[model samples]
Target: MRYAVALAVAMAGLQAMPAQGAGQRETGLEETLAQRCDAAAASPFDRDRPSGVPGVPSHEIDPAIAIPACMAAVRAAPEVPRLWYQLARADLAARRFDEFRDMAARAEALGHAGGAHALGQSHEAGHHGARDLAAARRLYEKAADAGFAPAMVDLGVMLEDGTGGTADVAAANAWYLKAAEAGEVAAMNLLGDNLVAGNGIGRDAALGARWYRRAADKGDGFAMASLGLLLELGNGVPRNMKEANAWYRKSAVAGNRRGMRLLALNLETGNGLERDPRGAVSWYKRAIEAGDVMSMRLISFSYFNGTGVPKDPQEGLYWLRKAAEAGDPAAMVTLGLRYTAGSNVPLDFERGLGWLRKAAEQGEPRAEAALAVLGDAPPGRSACRSVLGDYHALDARYGALPARFSGTLPAFRAVCAGFPGLKEDDVRRCHLLNPDGAGDFVRRVRKQCR
Candidate 1:
């Protein structure tokens, strides 16, 4: 989620370059030094690694080891563009931005496609103190035209998003196709998304599925999850719950947070697997630990209803508050309602209104609607509005209530019983909006209310 320069975007440009001969150094010594640099800095996406040599991801490159080795290699073969680029990569990993700029510039001047791409990334990320999307795009084009698959993908993204120029969906698709044909997994995944969504590309779900499959086969966890969703919904593939569950499991195991949340939902509901509430909770916890905020909301529900765990209202409220604090608008609305209604909490109208106002500022429709009706009502009318707001929010989120919700209606009625100041108009409004469908109960309540 590093928006400045996404890891995939930065890594996509590290294409391998063949070593060019420098001065009159011995071939053996030059080869030896270049090999050392490659050992420390070869990218996993590099297309031309020596046999049996594994490529390293940028984040995994140890600057401590790579920097010194690449520097020595550059010293030995100053004319070798690859060595200079490798030194730049090591500097980038170490956050030595100025050093990276200098070395990468030198490497690009020496005809290294990866070095050009690196420069593009720096410009795009504002590492030069100001973002230059136009410069980034030009550099990406140069590298992409030179047959660097990662550069092709990055350039496609820029064109698709119109980051530095007019949007060109057709041009973006062409770049994606080129990169995908060259075996860029990120390109394959993005191509699948565009094709499926028909985002200025041809709508071909089956073809999109094929591209996703190819990327998933390359061990892309995000692609695995996308394929699973397609299979689950019969969008691009036939509905196959078992197959979908298998893919979801694979994606989750591979550390995709979306996959983890989806698999947990299926496990909890027995949608595509045997119901295992305990297992579902375990996965939800794992997702939360992985920084997924939605899972916090789900786990809160489990705690509230004692599903797979003891019913602990305080714990449930704790998770709900955590979610709200983390900027979940839905959680903020729910927390606001609970506080205003004094449901498992002390009545604090001002605190509840504050939460609602915060959510409304974020454009949460539910909070906006609730505030519209309840913001300045008198005590009795406010109590009535609180019940209505709580019911509406719940119905919007979950149409069918579980056994745990059975107490909610009775609790609502109790509020009405206590608020004798209720007007006939308030009771009529509640009856009209209530989904309980018990007109007789509403009539009887109307008769008894003050």
Candidate 2:
């Protein structure tokens, strides 16, 4: 939400004329930086290509080499804001806060868009002082208005998050669209997010897919993962788990945490790739190291099932508690079950019920079910105990145990007989077994036409 995106968006200042010899012959800081850029281009280890290219960089100069040359160039042309901008970049690379701040501010005062953007980055990051959202916004606005695409995206993020002012999702989306049109790849991904979520716009999955494609084509990792999710779910495209897995792998290689989690899931489930529990565990651990709580929950499941690592219910319980404590409602309900059933932990009714209540407060459906069934029941109600057992057993059959699954209400009435006011299809109830000794189908769905 900080209106300070990557500083690599500019270094040698805005495209200063062309990279030709005639343009470089002019005596100014731009020429000096231009020449330095050419030197960098000649090096196999360095690059300066910007926009819509994979495995390329935007302003990939050796800050160390550019530092001394930029310092001298600034000395020669103190009035040229671009020279001061380059000096500021060098100062930033060297961690020279006082000089960086001073030069960046001076360049901004002298009408340099990149300088304004640089100062915004510093303010947003609290590099030279305390974080200043207000200053960051003002500087970013100026730079964005001056046609800095990165600043436009940063400003949009701040507007959407309401960090610097009141949240205006519509305005935020507008800025994202602007930046996306201007070829800011990150903005393309963000614009897709806005479209999909209907944040300041009507929810349009096709439009979201379009923008995601644009960014993903540019090899943006976030866009790749997002598009993969859409493809996997058939949200705005066909369900193609194979293609989804490919994108997930690409995004993971690009270091996207969500990509790592998704790839781990595919590996765990053998959905589009060969099942590799150890590989799944490895990716989950990587995602956890990057602070993904969702991965923590999945990793707990691996431990519990002995799918990736050795089966260790104790370690599973440990991770479940950690995930629950970290605010995963599903894990919270699972933890509550652990305490309630004492299957993996001690049965402490009060504590277990308390955990369930907390999870229910967060709108976890399984927690609500637990409360409805056992809120007031102690260990001695034989009917309630039997019903709860049947409920869980059905879920286990359907592979969603501890998670709510649908059931036919008439079947429930036939089993729990005289249950009041229940007369509809139920996605909330578990499947019931036939009371008949023959074990034939009862109220379960018989066939699928499609």
Candidate 3:
């Protein structure tokens, strides 16, 4: 990231001259001293020397002067690995990629401890020149072998995806473990994922949750979202919708799109809490604004059905089109329905059939039924009726019954007798279908039965 200098300046005291016997000896000594000085100046690991008075000669000089002095110092004392590293770093800063590589190679050959890591990072980033993943990997491995945890993590990532060599999940896991033990936040997240997914290790959801919690507590947004999802799904922990909601809220507030979507669903459905349609709409809007495709689909559904807000067919069609363009199967189906019904638009059989065919190709049942109906009027009607029967059957199993029907005493009696798995939360959500207490007759039956 450092800016490269375009020009080099000679030191005021050291002038270029023809080398004779004695003169060459003096020049070599002066060059060696200059190289040593430059090396010392370039070392980031060392404390910087105090600045000298203006116009005064000192160990620390402007880089233009310091570079030549350091070259001279290296000429005089060529065995110093630190000096070689300094020269290499200087060349790197000056955007002299080839020279930096050569100097770094020399520094490494001289057994410089830190230069390898820097060289690896530079190559990995392509900072001073062209990217060389192979070279970066080699140097990273060397540094990791030298007990550098950062290098171990970087090497692990490279190996995990086969960036510079063959994929080695086991090796990647080992390196991640090493870095995690050394307190690397990124490595901890990777290790947790590996453990959770059973990659290069046995699946241990509990252990994964523990690690995710640790990283989440440390402000890792991905970890927070991961942990929240597990809690919501009752994976590796007792299902606690309240805790899941809390965590989702945390991540959503922190700009997590998934969290925003889930929170919206929970609010809309009154899952594990009081229902808040307005709150649901707000969260859905946020998720949609954040570019969550599913959220856009849900928003379109809401508008189409007049759920939680006034119906706006135009808005519904607009969002449906957006979601369909994003390749959402459900959106394609909805679009096909809109075109077929001529809702807020002209009825176009061809357009409707085209959209239906697209959805049917993706195995959408409604689309398939629509396509069958369009093919042969009578047979299609029969096929559609059969499909509708199947669809309603599936809906009864997974979806809530309408509140109006459930509010009838006889209907309530039938449901309570037939479906023992219905929870209070499910019943409460059903009430929201009417959004009014007009369904209180059903409550009377329950109270009388009790």
Candidate 4:
């Protein structure tokens, strides 16, 4: 995650130079800070490496070497928080969980507070050998208490999810606010979502947009997606399809799956850009491979319609089945239709009814209508609840959303232009409006364009 990387880079800043000796030695803290800033400004993605590596290594290196260098540096200067933090990185990469924990402990003992926070992350990631969420929580709490920005986010996530603890939306919001105040970009996005959704916070679309923009500016992909959605739908900001597309493109280039899917749609339909079905297909494939259910559904549709790729009934059916199995309501409805029509698969009333029931339970109006046509009552509403449970299961296996943004216009523009049938007037009307209204608008756009 970008949040983790940014925190690591921040800690590295504190390690760039050795501290002063007791009496005569000069403290190079300021010089170290300047050097770190210069390096970060030059290339934010570059990871710090050992001096032993030749040829000015420009990219991230293997954790094995980096950890040792950090450990050696810490041995030479135990009080340096950066060295401890760097060592932890190496240990995490090398899968030396116990060592990382021990090193983090040592760093904390030596007054390197950030080390404690990094240690918590390692625990959460099950670095080294074993999973230990309790240990991670303890370390997260310790780091949060020590005023570390990332720790606040980490603690907030844990509380929000009730992972390794009880769910506490209030506590989560407090931690998110603290992290936001400390300039943690991901926390800003999370806080924005909470504000917009009225989850443990009063609804505030404008404030939500503001927070999303802050994270988007910092190159957070999800934030870019959220901001683009807001702008495109006119929620808390002026409706601007061009701006929305630009943000989507920005997020897509940064490896956001939803952005890629949206961008693909734009390419296929020429919403704000020139139509390019081949390019759209490429983007859609990428998103599908990354486990976006909507992408899967779109891919199936494309196959069925012979839009970008050659028409293949089998392929269409396969993708539709994949989406349905993954709990996509539209996919379930489509499958039901296919069964009812005896198209692409055998005509079986029992199977058709089963799929229709699944879709209807999830509140698919089409499925409900089809059931009515078949002289059957709509399935139980409990199916709607099951949809959310299924969504969580899928999200856990595949990442939920894009995690970073590139902050480029081409990227953003793609997302804005991708969703079809989005009128300029509709976009303008949703800006800075009520959250419920904004959400409804987004749903309308998604349903129509998708």
Q: Best candidate per lDDT, number?
A: 1
Query: Which lDDT tens digits does candidate 1 get at residues 168-286?
Result: 98899999999999888899999999999998788988899999999999888888988998898788789999998998899999988878878887887687799988998998898
Under the 3 Å rule for N, CA and C atoms, how many clashes does model 1 have?
0
lDDT of 2 by residue, 359-399 (tens): 88998765777677667664654343344433432332223
Error of 1 at 179 (Å): 1.9
What ranges in model 4 sit over 4 Å off? 1-65, 78-82, 95-98, 109-111, 126-135, 326-329, 352-450
Per-residue lDDT of model 3, residues 163-264, tens digit only: 988889899999988877766667888888888899888898888888888877877666777787788777787788889888888878888777887777
Better of 1 and 3 by lDDT: 1
Error of model 2, residue 4, in angstroms: 27
TM-score of 1: 0.75
Considering every candidate listed, which one attains the maximal TM-score?
Answer: 1
User: Global CA lDDT of candidate 2, please?
Assistant: 0.68
Error of 4 at 132 (Å): 4.5
Measured on C-alpha atoms, candidate 1 has an lDDT of 0.76
In model 3, the Cα lDDT at residue 339 comes to 63
Q: What residue pairs clash in candidate 1, if any at all?
A: none
What lDDT would candidate 4 get against the real structure?
Answer: 0.65
lDDT per residue as tens, model 4, 39-147: 2221111123234322211234355346434543554456555566556555655666787777777766765556777777777877666778888888888878877
